[model samples]
Target: MTDQALPRVVDQATWQHELDALRVREKAATRELDAIAAQRRRLPMVALPDYTLTGADGPVRLVDLFDDRQQLITYHHMWFPDAEWQCGGCTSFTAQFTRLEFLAPYDARFVVVTQGPIGEALAYKEKVGNKMDWYSTADSPFGADMGAGPGEGFAVNVFLRDGDTVHRTWHTDGRGTEQLTHTFALVDLLPYGRQEEWQDSPPGWPKTSTYSKWPGSEDVAAAYGPQGVSA
Candidate 1:
């Protein structure tokens, strides 16, 4: 049978109703995952050590970036100064960094660290109108120490600090544009949300629309506007 003429396993109404039900199930699953995360937050904490990174005013220590806070979430953008262009994926990720203030109440500070020179990093941040603090790991070996250096793989690593000690808490390296969705981790517990996009759909069910092809190249920045291309 041709693709469009496949056997009708279920009628349209039944299929849509099932899709709606699946969406509800996915939302329930996400809620459970969030509750588990809340429990994880109450786990025992560890002290963090002080580490310094280069900033506009010269070397600014890690403790200073924390601003006396107990936790820090660094973006660790992949900005090899000499590269022809910044990492397109990293560029997309930084574009979403506009909502940095929303993360403050979580008792953590967010900052971006790049391997580019102070001038280049500052220029990119200015171009994008970034609200978060930006730093350059060019001078010190901080990027290498943090596993954010070129070829070591990319990830979002969360660290905890108390007094003068720092400890790694969590990290995630989602693939593709999906990786650009760290903020989505906080999506609400609604039936028609996330993971639901891929849930079961009966025969003849229409596919969900998307912004771009999955894991599209860095060149798809036109739709992302200046936010994605600024860097």
Candidate 2:
């Protein structure tokens, strides 16, 4: 079925009636999301050793990523030196973090960790117009310990700091990565949905396997037009 076949046009009263019914389900879903977060907060954490990573300024330890904050949020952006292209999926996820100030009130430091030189990581960051801290774990065991096992995993690992010790409280990859990208969440609400082949979209809806196709830095600078990306 196509979009025209679904969600038939309705009068004001009928629309309101259907919306009111869906509101009940929406509220229940919100509560369930809250409960899941509560359960996540209660999960056991693992102590992590201090690992070295390269930043624009220079080398820094893992604890340094906390930036004096109690919590550290890291995105495991998949990038290997041998590959010519950055992972488009990672770029799509990293693109949403351009607004670095939004997380300030939460009292946590956010960063992206990758497996390349600082310059290479910076190139990818430049392409995405990223503002959050970007780090390179080329010579570190960080990825081996916390990252996705093969094919350059896109993952997020949350750490909590207590004095001199840091513990990994949560780590997730694959579909769990959806929790970050607003694009994914917003697209899910649209009539055509994500418009990706894997999604359960309507029969005639657009579908592509290249959902993560990333553009080059110059392309982003041209497309962004201002604010974040600059030539």
Query: Which candidate should be chosen as best, given lDDT against the real structure?
Result: 2
TM-score leader: 2
User: In order, what lDDT does every prediction score?
Assistant: 0.65, 0.76
TM accuracy, model 1: 0.67
For residue 196, give model 1's deviation from the true position in Å.
17
Clash pairs detected, candidate 1: 47-165, 48-162, 48-165, 48-166, 49-164, 49-165, 49-166
List residue ranges in candidate 1 displaced over 4 A: 1-16, 35-49, 176-231
Reference-based TM-score, model 2: 0.85
lDDT of 2 by residue, 39-107 (tens): 999999999787788889999988888888888889888875666557766765676566777666787
Give the CA lDDT, 0 to 100, for residue 40 in model 2.
Answer: 95
Model 1 accuracy (lDDT, Cα): 0.65
Write model 1 residue lDDT over 76-111, tens digit each, in one string: 777754664566666656666666676668778878
